[model samples]
Target chain A: MSLLNNIYNQLRISHKYVNRLFKERSCYISTSPIMRDLMEFFDDKKNWGATEVKTGRSWTKDDLRIKSNTDLHKLWYVLLKEKNMLYTMEHEHNDQVRLFPSPERLDKVLDSMENLEEVVRERNRAYYELETTEIGEQTHKTITGPFGLEIDYYETEHSIPKEVNAQWQKEQNTKCRPEDVKSFLLKYKEKEYLQNKKQQRRNFNHVIGLLNRFPKMDMEALKEQYPDVDIEKAKASRKYKPPLVFD
Target chain B: MRLTQILYTKIGEWSKKYANLPDRYIKRAMEQVYWRNPKGIQYRPNTVVKRKKFHFTLDRPWSAQFAETNSPGRLHPKVFVEPIKKWSFFRGDRVEVLVGKDKEKQGIVKYIVQERNWILVEGLNCKLTKLDRGGVKIYIQEEQPLLVTDQVALVDPSDLKSTGFEWRYTQSGEQVRVSLRTGRIIPVPASAEETRDYKAKGLYVEQPKDTSEKDLGEVTFEPTLKTFEMEIMDQMGIKEDRIPKKSYWY
Candidate 1:
C-alpha cells in the first residue's frame, strides 16, 4: 500500500510537469503576438473622450465585389470585432454619462458589413443560378389571408410532407366566415380609397401653393414632380390665383 | 411608408453634397420622433409620429441650431418652395447680384441653401447687425441669402458680365454650363467638389483607422466556379461527408 501511494505521487508530479511544458509551448505557438485580451473589446485609448473621431466612408459594394471569398471571410470577422468594440464603447460611455464620440462609426461599420454580405450573397446566387435553375434562396409566396389581405408567407422546412401534415393542413385550411371576410375586405378597401383620395387632395393643394408662390415656375417640372395631380384642374382652383400683371 | 420620409426627401441633394455626411446620419441627427408605437400586435404596426415639416433656414439640417429651431412643440409657418427641374447653382461659382444694395456686384458663391433656392455670395448682400457682448455693442456684417432665381445671375467668364446660362453637353459628353450670350463653357469650379472634410476627394487626408488606398485598389479576386460558402469551406479544409436530409418546404 505504501509503494502504491509513492507511485501515484510520482505520476501526479510528472503530469504537472507535462502540463507546464505544454502551456509554455502554447505561449510560443500563439498565432498573434498582440494579446487579444478583453481590452480589445474597447476603442483605442487615444480615441477616448474625443470630440470627433474622423474616419473614411464605409466600404462600397463594388469594393467588396472585387475581394476574394477568403478576404471577405477575414473582413467579416474584422468588421464584427469593430462593431462589438464600438457597441461596448458606446455602452460604457452611456453608463459613465459621457458623450459617445463619432457615433457614425457604428453606422459605417454596419454599412460595410451589409455591403459585404450582399456581395457574398450575389456570388452565391450567381453560382446557384449557374448550377441550378433556381436562385437557391428561401422561397416565399403571396397568398390571401383569412381577412382577404395579401400576406407574404415564407416557406419553412418541415419534417413531414405538407400534404400528410394534418395539423399544418388544418391551419392552412382555417378561414373566416365568407360574410365576415367580405365585411372586413370592404372596410379595408374603403380605408385604402380614403387614403388615396387624401393623398390626391394634398398633392393638388401643394401644386396650387407652388403656383401661387412662383408664378414663372417650370410647369413641366411641376407636372413631373406631382404626376398624379391634375395640373389644369389645380390651376382652375380658387386657391390658385393667377399672378397679377403690372405694366 | 412614413410621412417624415416624404418630407425629408424635400432636402435637396445639392444641399447635402457639401456636408459630406451619410444620408443615414443626417436622417438620424435631424429626425424628431415625438412618439412611436410599441412593438408587438400594434393596431398600426410600425406607426411613428414624428416631425413632418421642418423649417429650412440658413442653418444646416444636421446642425444643432437647426434641431433647436425645429424642436418639439414648435411649428414654423409653411414655406412654399419652387421646384426646379435641375439645380444649377454650386459652390465657388462667380455670380452677379441682381437685387439689393449689392446690385451688379460680382462675388463667388459662398454657401447654398437649395431647399429654399437660396445662395450666399461672399462679401455681398451684407446685413449689419449689432451684437451685445459684455456690455460692448459690436457691429458685425452678416451675409444674407439671395434668391438664386431672380436675385443673382451667373457671371459670364468671357465678358465678366451677368448672363443666363444653359446646361449643354460638350464634345466629350460632359455636361457644362454654357453662357447664352458668349457661348463659352463655364467650367464647374474645382471648389464645387469641396466638402467639410476635404477640399477635394483626391486631397482628402487618410485617417488612422481608414483602410489604405493600396489595399482598396488591390484586385485579389479570382474567378471561381464554387459558391462563397464552398470556397470558404475549402479554404478552411472543412469537408461535409453527410448529405442534408431531404425535407419538405411549406
Candidate 2:
C-alpha cells in the first residue's frame, strides 16, 4: 500500500515537472535517465554487481540553506526516490545473499534528508518568527506521567476542548494506585543512585590502574579526561603503587 | 556520560578523515548492541546494553578484521596509553624512526591508530612474517606501528633532518607546524587530504547520482518574506480558498 502511494506521488511529481518543462521551454533537463516505472525503485543497470559505488558526501545544512524553497521541494523528492531505490537494492541484495556495496550510501542519504528538512524548518521558523511571535513548529510540553516520570507530550489537534472531552479525561487518569506510584518512584530513584555509584567506582578503579601503569603520566590530562575520579584518592589506593627506582 | 560517548571521543579526527566514512555509519558498523530499549513506555527510557571496551588497532573500527579481533567473549589484555594534550601527527608526514633497526630512517606516515598514539611509517620499522600457503613459503616484510611520541620524530623539510616541532599560528591566523630548530614552516603535505573516497576534494569523480558542481553552486535563492510552504505552494499554483477550522491542541 505504501509502495503504491509512493509510486502515485512520483507520477504526480513527474507530471508536474513535465507541465513546467512545457510552460518554461527553458534548457533545464534532467541528467539521470527516468524509467517512469517500478524499475525506478532499483539503481542504474551499470551499478549492478559493482564492487563499490563511489558517491559524494551528503548535502550539508549550509549547502541547502542557500537553495530556494522550490529547489528544496524538488530536492526532497529526489532524495526520497534515492532513499527508496537504495532500500530496494539493499533488500534485493539481502535476499540474494550478496553483500551490499558501500552501505554507507544509505547513511549519507539519510543525513542529507535530515539536513534538508532542518534547513526547510529553519526557513519556516525565520519567517514565522518575523511575522508571528512564535517559531510555528509542533508544540510539546514536559508533563508528569502516571508512573511519576517526566514525559515529553506533543500536542495533537482535537475537535473538542479538553474539558468537554470525557473519553480523553478518563484515558488521562492515572492507571496505577497512589501507593504503586510511590513505590515505583522510590525504586527508580534507588536504581539511578546505584547506577551512579557503579559508574563512580568504575572510574576510580580505572584511574588506579592508569596510575599503576604510567607512573610519570601527566596528572592534568588524566584529571581532565576523568574529572569524577579523584586523583589523590586513586594515588593513595593500595593498587596504585609507584614504580620502584634504584639509585 | 555514557561509556560509548567517552569511547567516541577517543577516536581521533585525523583517523576518521582517512576513512572518509560518516560518524553515524562508523558507529553503526562498529557497535555491538546486545540489547536495546524498545519503543513505548519503559522504566529507563533510551537505555542500551552494548559492548563498551573496543580494542582499536591498525584495523579500522568499522573493518571486518576489527570485528573478528573484538569478537564476542574475546578479551584483550589491558594496554596503558599515555594521555596527550594534543595530537600532532598526521598522514603523509615525513618522520624519522628513533628505535629498532630502521632507526634514523626517514619515511612517510602510512597509517595512524590515534587511540594508542601509534603510527605506521612507510618502510621504517618492519617485521618479517613467513606465510605457508599450498606448501609454498613466502616471506613478507610488514610495517609495524611506532609510538608517535617517542619512537618517531618529524623530519624538518628545511635541512631534511629530524627535529622537534611546535604548533604556531602564522600572520593570517592559520595554525601550522613549525620546525623549532630552524624556525621554518613544516607545511602539511597535500597528500594528507587523501581519503578512502578520493585523493583530493577537487579531484573527486562525481557519480551519476551526485549533483553537479555547477548546479550546486548556482544561486537560485532570492531573499523573500515568505514561509517555505507558502513559497512552494505558490510555485505549484496551489490555491486554498477554504479556511482551516479552529481546533484545540492537547
- Segments in model 2 whose C-alpha atoms lie over 4 Å from true places: A1-33, A244-247, B3-5, B8-10
| Candidate 1 lDDT for residue A79 | 92
Query: How many steric clashes does model 1 contain?
Result: 0
For residues B1-250, what per-residue lDDT tens digits would candidate 2 score against the true structure? 5652485335787788878998889988988988999987775678888888888888888899999989989989877677776788888999999999998899999888888889999887889999999999999999999988678999999899999898899999999999999999999988888998789888899888789999988878888999988887788799888998888988
> Which tens-of-lDDT digit does each residue in A12-92 have in candidate 2?
999999988775753344334553567889988999999899998899988888898889988998899899999999999
Interface Cα RMSD in Å, per prediction? 2.2, 1.8
Instruction: Give the residue spans of candidate 1 off by over 4 A.
Output: A1-33, B1-8, B34-45, B130-139
| Most TM-score-accurate candidate | 1
Worst 10 residues of 2 chain B by lDDT: B1-10
TM-score of chain A of each: 0.87, 0.83
